[model samples]
Target: MKSEETPFEGGPMDGRSLPVLVGPTGNPPKTYRIPVPDDAGGPPTVLVYRRVPRAHSKRLGLPKGWKYEFDPEGKRGGGPRWPWSKPDPAPDATPGGKPDDTHG
Candidate 1:
């Protein structure tokens, strides 16, 4: 398929339309919606959908320090869970020296 054939060529994804893959083949295509947190903070979340290789899923551009997990029954179960809480901060060590990286 041609690159322009994909739905993303129109412009920045509106986070609603289903973007199909342009080329190549793999396991049966699946649809995934990633909820990106709003910079201003509100109830309206940006929902981006992708119908492509699982490896390409990371292109959704999740926020730094945040993470996500795939839900096999996503579309049926509502949607994938998001990283709601901040990740635990690394443990601190003596103030004089660099923090220990060996342990969490």
Candidate 2:
């Protein structure tokens, strides 16, 4: 039930610090979602923010703290996929057609 005052960067939440609930692992969720009510009273738009390292250790170069950065795409999160469930099927071809593309 602990929370951390996490700072968010970019987007509508820029320069704002909000208390984010931390999990049992003592880290914030990978994605932070904020629901913004529409002015016209339509469905609320959820803004997605992704967690990132705020600073790194000098000696080991490991993450010291965490912060949130705006995700412009705001892709929809998928439901939980258990290990026993079937894996996602592979794409037929690579759309980008890049040489380094694994699905090419």
Candidate 3:
């Protein structure tokens, strides 16, 4: 007898599953399906969907260190506005130059 080449050849995903649609408050959003890894046991992962509304909206329950802004035309202006300012660089680094090692 010959062995199967692929793991999904005769597995649970034998063509009985369907795609799922995910989105926020809007008429048209994104759609995708959950992927099944080759190995049954693996590290966990998460998927996030970002949407830009035409008008002002409430905040979302995003994870820590995650940020989002609403832009009608999706343009990058002025450096960064409130709620999304740039973080300070390392202490040994210059304003626009390379870093300096004094303690090393």
Leading candidate by TM-score: 2
Model 3, 7-58: lDDT tens per residue? 1111333323222233353132321123445465885432222222324434
What C-alpha lDDT do the candidate models reach, one value each?
0.40, 0.90, 0.34
Per lDDT, the best of the predicted structures is 2
Output the lDDT of residue 94, model 1.
62
In angstroms, the error of model 1 at 76 is: 8.1
Better of 2 and 3 by TM-score: 2
| TM-score, one value per model | 0.23, 0.73, 0.20
Query: Candidate 2: which stretches are off by over 4 Å?
Result: 76-104
Q: How accurate is candidate 2 locally (lDDT)?
A: 0.90
Local error of candidate 3 at 31, Å? 15
lDDT per residue as tens, model 1, 1-104? 42222232112353223423333632213443556677888865544333432233367853322112334343443345569945444466466667667976
Residue-level lDDT of model 2, residues 13-37, one tens digit each, is: 9999999999999999999999999
